[model samples]
Target chain A: EAGVTQFPSHSVIEKGQTVTLRCDPISGHDNLYWYRRVMGKEIKFLLHFVKESKQDESGMPNNRFLAERTGGTYSTLKVQPAELEDSGVYFCASSREYDLGLSIGAGNTIYFGEGSWLTVV
Target chain B: DQQVKQNSPSLSVQEGRISILNCDYTNSMFDYFLWYKKYPAEGPTFLISISSIKDKNEDGRFTVFLNKSAKHLSLHIVPSQPGDSAVYFCAAGDYTDKLIFGTGTRLQVFP
Candidate 1:
C-alpha cells in the first residue's frame, strides 16, 4: 500500500507571507490528523478529521492557522501571515477508524507522511 | 508542560548489542503507548506498542515494556544493527485519542 504523501517537501517564505501545505493520506483511511514539530521539540498535534468533519481542533495554535479536509479525501493546512515561529515540520497522518474489539495495536496505529518542512525568514 | 519526555537526547550502542530507550509520561490517563523510529527528513514509523493491561510486548527483535504504576515505558532492540540507527520517539494516548509525543532520542549503532 502506498504511504501518506505530502506536497512541497520543503518551503521557505518571508515572514507575514501565506503558505499552504497539502497532504494525501493512505487510501480508505478516514481518520486524518495534522501535527507539527518545531526544531528540537516533540511533535505536537494540531487537529484531527474524521472524514470531513473535524473531531478535535483543540491543538490548533492560533487563529492564523487553518486546516481543512475536503471531500473526506485529502487535507490542507494553511498559515496566514506566517510568523517566524511558524517555521517547523508539519506532518500529516492517517489511520483507519478503531474497532476496539479487533486489535488495538494495528487498529489505532497511525501512519505518517514525509513531513513538509517550512522555514520562515 | 510536556506530558511525555525522553530524558536522554542521544544514545550510542555497538552493533550486535542491545539498545534500550526509556520514556516517562506524566499523564496517568494515557493507556496506550507506542514507539516510533524516524530517520532524518522522514516521518515516524511505528516500531512497537503496548497497552496498559500488559507489562511487556515483544516483536521479532523489538520489545516494549510498560510500567503503569511508575508511568514509565521502554523500548529494547536486540542485536542492534547499523540500519537501526535513528531517532526514536515515545508516544502515549488514551483510547482512540490523539497521541502526545516526547522529544526523540537519537540512537547511533556502530560496528
Candidate 2:
C-alpha cells in the first residue's frame, strides 16, 4: 500500500563525480519508468523497465546515464562523471497494466519522490 | 522536438468559478491523453485521462476534452476551489506506453 519511494531526497556533487538514484516501485507493478526535468525545462522521459528488462531508453540524455532494474522490483539510475547541466529533479513511476486507463497504480499516479534534487556543481 | 505543449504558463480564477487549462501536441502518433496535477515539492498525480476512442471524459468536477484532429486537449474544473490550485500537465502517449509531457500550466484559484 506504500507509494513509490526514492532515496537521497537531495544530492549535491561536484562535476565529474558519480551519483546513483534508487526507486522502489509498488510491489507487483510490471511497468517502471524514469523521468526528469532540468532546471528550466519540461520533464522528459529517461527510460522504462518491465520486469527487470529495459523496455525503452530512447529518452536517455547520454551514455553517461545508465539505468538498471534488478529483478524488476526496484530500479536504479546512475549518472557518472556528472556534468553541470545534469542538475534537476528525477522521478520514477510505475503502472500495473498497459490498459487504456484504470489498472494504473496510485504509484502509477506517478507519485514523485520528494524528488532527488540533483545539483551538479 | 517538443510534441506536447502547454501554451499558457499560468491561469488565475476566483473561487467558485470555472478554470480551464489547455494543451496541444504536434504528434499524430499520440493515442491517449492525460492530465496530471502537481504540487511544488511532490510528483505529478493523475487527475484524469481520455483515449483516442473517446472525445470527452469526466469525473466529478474535472472534465477532460480531447480533439485528436487538432491535436489539442483541455482540463476543465468547474466551481474551482482553492485546493485545486497546482501545476497541471498534459501528456500524450505514443506507440510505446511512455507519457510525453508538456511544460505544464500553473493554476491559482483564489478564495
Candidate 3:
C-alpha cells in the first residue's frame, strides 16, 4: 500500500509570504493529522481530520494558520505572513478510522525535511 | 499542559549493553502507550505499544513496560546495537482519538 505522500517536500518562502503544505493520506484511511516542530521544541499537533471534517483543531498555533481536508482524501495546512518562528519541519500523518495505530506515510516522518528551510528575511 | 515527559534528552550506551529509556505521563485518562523511533532526516517509525490493560509488551529485542500506578512507562532494548541509535519518543492516547507525544530522548549506541 502506498503510504502518505507530501508535496513540495521542501519550501522556502520569505517573511510575510504565504505557504501551503499538502499531504495525501493512505487510501481508505479516514484519519489525518498535522504536526510541527519549531527549532528545538517538541513536535506539536496542529489539527486533525476524520474524513473532511475537522475533529479537533485546538492545537493550531494561531490565526495565521489554517487547515482543510477537502473530500477527506488530501489535507492542507497554510501558514500566512510567515514568521521566523514558523521555520520548522511540518509533518502529516494518517491512520485508519477504528485502528489507533497510525500507518504513517514516508514523507510525514517528524525528523527533519531538508526542511522548508524558510528564510523569513 | 505537557502530558507526556521524557526527562533524558540523550543517552549513550555501549553496544551489547541494555538501554533503558523512560517516559512519564500526567494524564490519568490515557490508556494506551507507544514508542516511536526516528533516524536523522526520517519520520518516526512505530516501535511497539501496550494498552493499559497489559503491564508489558515485548517485541524482539525491544520491551515496553507500563506502570499505571506511577503513570510511568519505559522502553528497554537488550543487546543494544549501533543501528539502534536514534531519537525515541513516547506517546499516549486514550481512545481520545489522537496521540500526544513527548519531546523525545536521543539514544546513541556506542560501538
- TM-score of chain A, every prediction, order shown: 0.93, 0.89, 0.82
Q: After TM-score superposition, what is the CA distance of residue A56 in candidate 2 from its true location, in Å? A: 0.4
Per-prediction TM-score: 0.96, 0.93, 0.90
Q: Candidate 2 on B1-111: residue-level lDDT in tens?
A: 889999999999999999999999998877778788989978888788777778888889999898888888899999899999999999888557888899999999998
Put down candidate 1 lDDT per residue, B10-96, tens digits, no spaces: 999999999999999999888788899999989999888887778999999999999988999999999899999999999888755
Candidate 3 structure quality by residue, lDDT tens digits, B1-111 = 899999999999999999999999999888678788987766667788887777888889999998999999999999999999999999887654567889999999999
lDDT of 2 at A27: 74
Arranged by TM-score, best first: 1, 2, 3
Place model 1 in a CAPRI quality band: medium
Off by over 4 Å in 3: A98-119
In the range A8-116, model 1's lDDT, one tens digit per residue, is 8999999999999999999999989899999768999999899999989999999999999989999999999899999999999988875221355554578899999
Residue B11, model 3: Cα distance from true site in angstroms: 0.8
Angstrom error at residue B84, model 1? 0.8
Q: Across residues A1-121, which tens digit of lDDT does each residue of candidate 3 receive?
A: 7777777676888889998888887787787888777776787778888899988898998999999988878888888989888887877877765335232212122221222333455
Put down candidate 2 lDDT per residue, A25-52, tens digits, no spaces. Answer: 8777788889998985798889988789
Better-scoring candidate (TM-score), 2 or 3 = 2
Fraction of native Cα-Cα interface contacts (under 8 Å, chains A and B) also present in model 2: 0.53
